[model samples]
Target: MPETIFRNWTSDLSRDWGKKPIQIDHSLSQNELFSKDALAELIERYPIEHYSLMRTSSRGEEKKIWRRGEVGGLSGHEVMAQIASGGLWLQLRELKLVDKRYHDLLQSIYGEVEQRVPGFDSFNHEMGVLISSPNAKAHYHADLPGQALWQIMGRKRVYIYPAEEPYLPQEELEKIALTGLESALRYDPEFDRHALVLDLEPGQMLTWELNAPHRVENHDELSVSMTTEHWTEEIRREQMLTVANGILRKHFGVSPKRRSTEGAGFWAKAVLQAGWRRSPWYKREQRKMMPVDFRLAPGTSTTIVDIPAYVV
Candidate 1:
């Protein structure tokens, strides 16, 4: 049987999630585990759906827009196309819970990976489970905190772009982040080179630095995976302050405490901004960030890995 689900089960995900560069071959065997039948079951069991039209405040006009359909909705692909065309803020959550067969697979995989490196908690409430489809495109946006995507089952092709140089601006990022994980896109047209292209199969995992631009395409017939997000208090505090600032800017049309934002707010956005800009925090943090690589054998052995903390 699978381990009992804890409301705080995600506590395990944050520990040691980003302490060192990741290496997975030591923890699990190098092989794929899920069978074709298992993959088919996942495809048929989940209810797919698409999106209707949505309206967003663009400049001064009420613009008509649409997004990639929610997980259980229809025309998920069309929703994505619409989103790519006009851009929208999105937050895709899992509708159908995972099954025992899949949950058991994760338990075994986690066991082997966690034995090596431990996990660290960022003390945030955000935790997520794998959906039936892996085709969810996050667009070309960067995150405030780091993210680790584990391929519990099926295969996916991931394209990653580096941070720094031709960076995405603040206003665009704030727009999406303020939208509350809803349909939004903040892509940079000038970014050069695809940093990494990965063909992730079962038991394999990947992690990239916070705000690192990346997109995924589900290659196989169906895909299932877990993406546990983490962001440090530092990152969260900055985002919270950004939201607060955005609220003031939009709702009341007033800027608050900017007289000298150095010592203001919980985490103090001004301090973080200065540190993030001048200091080596970005590079140091990037160096501390690592990719989690995992592979499992066809039989019964288990695998495990830390689900590091993120700012978001």
Candidate 2:
């Protein structure tokens, strides 16, 4: 491992950390922990509940398809081979909780960020690994927490848009917060004209403003990347406000006009959201895991066999 995860950190990077879209050089590509062999081993032992194997439509396809599958009896290398054949992606979610080495690495990453950025304290950190096939696309979406993308191998083009208005409407954000569904945000091709598009390569990482809408397309090779999520005090307050506003708009037929984070109104909304969390509706509104509908074929690298769907 290198002495520092970030390779080309500067004063400007620290100054613009999360206020805008920015990309910086990193050293994780050189770490053995991210090597193909190591990642394959991790996948072989990964818990089924902590991973998502998805097949989606290829690039330029008008209809979108997102289906869940399982790795079945294939080895990690075979899974990668199948993914490289195209139209598939795997997300090893919550690596920090699944592996101690990754957990330590996640801690080191945020610790470095806190050291470089003044008064920037973040908690509830999570880290996940993404392995995707060539030409695969991650649909336009917005996340509720602070997010960053780190590329360990291959290349990808990322398009990031402003976090307000038509790109990310208040209602859509509230819906996501209320249901824990990140990919439910509406998208328009025209919005790409106003986006900041950047090609992320090996040893690069990107971070944007909180809740900024973004999408990605992988280049003509298998790609390996890491995604880290965290929450700051301000972000938590914003989420609380979103949930409270969603509840008011959805159930009480009232439109919330206040967006302030520090006032009597904000406190009242915070209490409202807190109370709602303890209610039964909150449990009912949470997103459920998709069922495993298909599995990798036993001998063929890219073949999938449809099976009776069942939730893990």
Off by more than 4 A, model 2 = 59-64
Q: Report the C-alpha lDDT of model 2 over 89-208, residue by residue, as the tens digit.
A: 999999998999999999999999999999999999999999999988888999989999999999999999999999999998999999998878989999999999999999999999
> Which number leads on TM-score?
2
Task: Give residue 185's lDDT in candidate 2 (0 to 100).
Answer: 90
After best superposition, candidate 1 residue 85: deviation in angstroms?
25
Query: Which candidate has the top score in lDDT?
Result: 2
Model 2: worst 10 consecutive residues (lDDT sum): 296-305
Give per-residue CA lDDT, model 1, range 119-236, as digits (tens): 4335332323343332433345566665667665557777777654455444545554555442244555445354567787766667665555676766523455555555665556
lDDT value for model 2: 0.93
- Candidate 2 — which pairs collide? none
Q: After superposition, which runs of candidate 1 have C-alpha atoms over 4 Å from their true positions? A: 1-119, 123-138, 143-145, 152-155, 163-165, 181-183, 219-223, 248-312
